[model samples]
Target: MQEFIPHRKCVGCMSIKPKKELLRIVRTDKGIFIDSKQKMPGRGAYICKDLECLKLAMKKKGLEKSLKVNISKDFYEKLEEFLKKLAVKSFDAEVWE
Candidate 1:
């Protein structure tokens, strides 16, 4: 059987790419934040998983508009740190599966 790939649009560039190629920003009961685990329940907006897209989202306040909530600088800082960590984990030699 052929495999199916999931593609999603990047709010920044409006380009459709495989799901794994994008980063997920979510707003949940705990408040808005980044969800690298992809298992969080809430409203989510996707970016290209690149710094450029992340920057554009910030510059235009795309996420805030999309989620219809204010995103604090503290949230941005924590999410930025997580994105960096995700980038590092992406290249990790170990497999969780």
Candidate 2:
């Protein structure tokens, strides 16, 4: 038997990619936060690490619909900032490319 690799779809790009390649956003009773470890409980949505995908997801309200909750503007701003920081720390370069 072969090991299975999980796959997830990006809410922004609608592209299917390996789970490890995407970022997970989870909505829990407490609030919404990026699930860096993909271990949070509650509804989850995936998005590409690229900022463009984040913009598209926000514009399309995909996260809101997927999480079945109203997302505030401040949350979006915070998510963007978090992603930017993660990109910086992970790649040590701009993620736009």
Question: What is the Cα-based lDDT of residue 2 in candidate 1?
Answer: 90
Runs off by more than 4 Å, candidate 2 = 90-97
Stretches off by above 4 angstroms in model 1 are 89-97
Q: What C-alpha lDDT do the candidate models reach, one value each? A: 0.75, 0.84
lDDT of 2 at 7: 100
- When summed lDDT is taken over every stretch of 10 residues in candidate 1, the lowest stretch is 88-97
TM-score for candidate 1: 0.77
User: Candidates' TM-scores?
Assistant: 0.77, 0.86
For model 1, residues 1-97, the per-residue Cα lDDT tens digits are 9999988788777789988788778898888867676667999888876767777778888788888899898877775665676678565312211
Per-candidate Cα RMSD to the true structure, in Å, reads 3.7, 4.6
State the lDDT at 46 in candidate 2: 93
